[model samples]
Target: MALIITDECINCDVCEPECPNEAISQGEEIYIINPALCTECVGHYDVPQCVEVCPVDCISSDPNMVESKEQLQEKYHALMGKQ
Candidate 1:
């Protein structure tokens, strides 16, 4: 599943650069994760970099945007232009 940044985010500006897929961005209030571009770092890293670097622990999997590991891998591949 794609990750979501909660309102608890402190806007520390750490999570943005940590995203391998460049899915995190500064929203009107807090950081936002683009679900379309998010793949939970499946094909890039063992863990989501944003979640790893988030000091406030505001990042979590989107229950509403639930997806399997295979689906995330496919999304990652597509984003990377892989076969």
Candidate 2:
């Protein structure tokens, strides 16, 4: 997944359904992204929808789960139809 929920998340459910790939889910105290299902909205929207809707600004790229643009694009297309 390109983004992750920080500890700052107030357990708010604002960022869940906003995900285009259905990647976000509720965790212990906050939401978590399913990396395998997360395409970072690459082939769906122009920007990361989760990052835009997060009230606490708790979403950030996963440093340990790095991916290249091409890889992201492939994932996006795999999950969504290409234009």
Candidate 3:
């Protein structure tokens, strides 16, 4: 599943640079994760880098954008232009 940044985010600016897919961005009020570009760090890292560096623990899986591990891998491959 894609990750979601909750309102609890402190806007610490750490998560943005941690995202391997560059999915996290600064929103009007808080950081937002773009599900289209989010792969949960699959094909890159063992865990989501944003989640790992998030001090507030505001990052979590998005139920609405639920996806399996295979799907995330596919997305990662697509993003990297891999076969």
Candidate 4:
């Protein structure tokens, strides 16, 4: 599943650069996670990079956008042109 940034975010800007897929960005308010580009760092790291660096622990799985590990791997490959 794609990770989401909650309203608890403090706009710390720490999670943006940590995303290997560049899925995290500054939204009108707090940072937002793009479900299309998000791979939960499956192909890059064991854990989601954004979740790793977020200062407030506002990042979590998007329950509404749930996906399996295989789906996320496919997304990662597709995003990297490996598929």
Best-matching candidate per TM-score: 3
| Model 4 alpha-carbon drift over 4 Å, by segment | none
Give candidate 1 regions above 4 Å deviation.
none
Give all candidates' CA lDDT scores: 0.94, 0.84, 0.95, 0.92
Q: Of the candidates numbered 1 and 3, which has the greater TM-score value?
A: 3
lDDT of 1 by residue, 1-83 (tens): 99999999999999999888899999999999999999999998999999899999999999999999999999988999998
lDDT of candidate 1 at residue 43, scale 0 to 100 = 94
| Candidate 2 C-alpha lDDT tens digits along 1-83 | 47888899987788888898899999877789988878788877888988898888989999988987788888888777664
What lDDT is obtained when candidate 2 is compared to the true structure?
A: 0.84
Residue range 39-81, candidate 3, lDDT tens digits: 9999999999999999999999999999999999999999999
Model 3 off-target regions past 4 Å?
none
Which pairs clash in model 1? none
Q: Rank all candidate structures by their lDDT, best first, as comma-separated numbers.
A: 3, 1, 4, 2
TM-score of every prediction relative to native: 0.97, 0.88, 0.98, 0.97
TM-score of 3: 0.98
lDDT of 4 by residue, 13-83 (tens): 99999999999889999899999999999999999988888878999999999999999999999999995
Lowest-sum lDDT 10-residue window in model 2:
74-83
